[model samples]
Target: MDFNFTEEQDMVRDGLSRMVREQYGPEERRQLIASDAGWSKAIWGQLAELGILGMSFSEEDGGFGGGAIDSMVIMEEFGKGLVVEPFVPTVVCAGGFLKHAGTAAQKEEHIGGIVSGERVFAFAYAEPRGRYDLANIETTAKKDGGDYVLNGHKAVVIGAPWASHLVVTARTGGERTDAQGISVFVVDKSADGIVTRDYATVDGRRASEVYFENVRVPADALIGEEGNALPLIERVTDEAIAAQCAEACGAMKVAHAMTLDYAKQRKQFGVPIASFQVLQHRMVDMYTEYECSVSMTYLATLRLDADERTRKEAVSAAKVRVAQAAHHVGQEAIQIHGGNGMTDEYAIGHYFKRLTIFDSEFGNIDHHMKRHIALAS
Candidate 1:
């Protein structure tokens, strides 16, 4: 029932906050994003040195044996810093799948590299037609001699530009959109017949439209049992949703604080706008939304180990609330900063753009609302 972080968790949180504050200021982040890789490998290595790259795994997997709460702490700080690193794609999404479904040898081979920050991974699950449905896979995987051949196209694969490996979903049995036939595979990024069209996204991150034409991998590339990856995929996706909600909370907190400070400084009618009753009321509303979002994020994270239904329901609820708060806080931040907020030179507009990306990723407000309603029914 207690929501307060334990000493260890607090330590990790504070350490990560201090590291980000000292290293990833707005100007530094801008320079990093403008670089060719669109992210900082130096910062990524520092995170590994700090043991944050391993926070989501267990001790046996070369991690600190932390859980969702630990991941939330690190991700919240990453969000605050507007990190362009592919931590979520590599450590959260791909690593979750590996930890839950990979063989022991697979774990050692893939997860070891992940924990050391030597390898980056992208979840190549999204298809051109797939919009939030985890089971909607159109890519086909067929049995070959001691291997599987994959052929399909994945859309908007975030982090693919920097990824050395990919966790891809394909149809091994049933029709597209059917849950019974999906499977997941670990594919090398430089494999033959693989073509990637990479570009920078609106939020200062990179993504790729990846095409697979007769891509072949050994049978050992399978993550878990064949034709039974739906359950695992769904579970990992839910974890990602929870993490995204937490990150959104962090971004919203920054946006709210920035807006308040701007209000206090920007004078109108010979007085600070923050002194105006209307602006004060708006700030109060932003704070209320942020606090509510924090409570919901914690509730969802605490419920991750509960029954599947309970956990998913809580995640959907938290995502819904977080999405609402993100929109409200992002817009208000921009409004408070006036025309200057729309410029790329200011950090507030960038925060708003990141919030907008968060709102659309995994699932949006309306998507989670429908999901929550379904769970309630």
Candidate 2:
């Protein structure tokens, strides 16, 4: 199968690439993350103007009618600049849910704001006790008169502080950890009885520990059928994993490039360190890992529409390889950069931190390895 991008896809990538180079330099990104908002609303508006926020939705949903490959293109660029925006949360995760299963009214109400960049969304799914298990929900949504009252805490909700709404998961009927009874809702973040304690993460993005205390949402807020949303959740998350793997590939590419440039510039024994054959071999190894990751990411993204078992197996397998590449490239970049790489002022270290945290997102290396094994079985 052909892996080349279409002309439109190439155009979107080149435009976004130029935008990242001009607008989000390393210094600009560093400062943006340091600010209280921890991201740039101005840049978000720029993305809206460029029609990126809507790139992955259907035309009926006020989008340009893009798909997972579109998201992969956009996210790879976002990763290069280490953008701290809520693209993954708002566009990939929440948008995936709406595009796949939302009611017409839900799409009409939410997708417009999202495409226009007037709204941001965070995915509040993982609990303090839930370690990578999508069905392990301790939060509950109980049926009330014409509404569902949500009560539970979501831990490490990425981008929550900046979100206007949340795509949240909760148990609606069956016991915790059961595949049945897990439901999803679109909740207004500022609703009564909702609380958030936000902080900066090691990777320069923001996250929150969010609590829902008797927060009532209209029945219309439900994204899919109650107690039967796990399959939908899995599908969306697999799509997300594809996008995220592309992002990691972008990060690895930049990290390896930076190390190569540093080696060419830094001198030892009156010659560039790059002149040394041993270091050259290491750099080559890093490049190889990055390329391998790119191929695996492509595999995952392409297989998203396959059967459930096929899709899950491909995503998990890709994630395992990509995570390993991220770790190897990140460590090598730092090692090649030596003492300077360890400084917070340098951008390579920041890249390293992002790559490190990337391993834990969606699922870790071991987690995906086990998942792939289970699918194989």
Candidate 3:
């Protein structure tokens, strides 16, 4: 399938690139990172004004009616800018969860606000075990009259510190990983029994450890049917993986460009490094890996609505290839810059750090490799 951006998508990319260059240059990003929120409200508002935050939602939902490919474009630009905003957690993952499984009332109440940037939301799926395996959840939600009482801890909940709400995954059924008792609920972060400990992540983002002690929500808060959210959760995870792969592709592109510029300007052995045949070959390899990532990401995005096995295979393939590409591109970019690459004074260092964090987030190369092998077998 063709992976070239359409005219409209190109316009979207160009607009974002221009905005980031004009408003969120390296210095601005640095200041935002050091701030308490670890992001810029001004930039977030600007993105909303541009309708980028709502571009992927349907028009009836107060969005531009763009699809997965539109989301991929936005994520790619965000990655290139090293945007510290919770765009993925709030807009992509949380919004996707609601769009796919939320009731009509739930969509009317929450999705428009999310699309308009009036509120932020996060997905609370990870637990203390630090695994992306949805079946490994230990959090429980027991029925209490017309409400469900939630009790457990969620670790590394991204954007939770700023989120007004969270889509939480809890055990409501059997004990096995593939048990049918899994369910999802919409929980207010300010609920009486909820406690949050917030911290800064390595990539200058905010994450929180949230504890729920008998937090209760009406049964209507449950997304979709009771004890049937696992399949939806799996689909959301695959979409997240696809989105991350696209971001990795963008990061690799930026890193490659930065390295190329550095090689042409930085001198070694009384000559520019770009003149060296060995260094040139390394840059070529980086370009090749980036192309592979871009191709795989597009494939996964196009096949998002396919059957579970096919979707898993495509997403896992993209994630594995992108994870490997991100690692190689990050290291090569750093190496090309020599000692300066490791310093905070340089933008390349920050890009490398973000790429490292992205590689481990969602699911890493090893995780996707195992998943791919299992699916193939």
User: Which candidate tops TM-score?
Assistant: 2
lDDT of each: 0.90, 0.94, 0.87
Task: Please provide TM-scores, in order, for all candidate models, with all chains considered together.
Answer: 0.98, 0.99, 0.97
What range of 10 consecutive residues in model 2 has the weakest lDDT sum? 28-37
Per-residue lDDT of model 3, residues 1-377, tens digit only? 56687888888889998997787777888888888778777787888888888988888777888878998998888788787788888788888887888878988998888877888888899988847787787889999999999999999998888899998999987884755889999988889899999999887788999999999999999998788888888888888888878887888898999999999999989999999999999999999999999999999999998999999999999988888888899999999899999998899898898888886777788888999999999
Model 1: per-residue Cα lDDT at residue 213: 99
* Candidate 2 displacement at residue 307 in angstroms: 0.9
Clashes of 3: 1
For residues 46-88, write the lDDT of model 1, one tens digit per residue. 8889888898799998888998889888888888988888888
Assess candidate 3 and give its TM-score to the true structure.
0.97
Which of candidates 1 and 3 is the stronger one according to lDDT? 1
Give the per-residue lDDT digits (tens) of candidate 2, residues 226-314.
Answer: 99999999999999889999999999999999999999999999999999999999999999999999999999999999999999999
Query: Backbone clashes in each candidate structure, one number apiece?
Result: 0, 0, 1
Q: Candidate 2 local accuracy as lDDT?
A: 0.94
Model 1: how far residue 240 lies from native, Å: 0.8
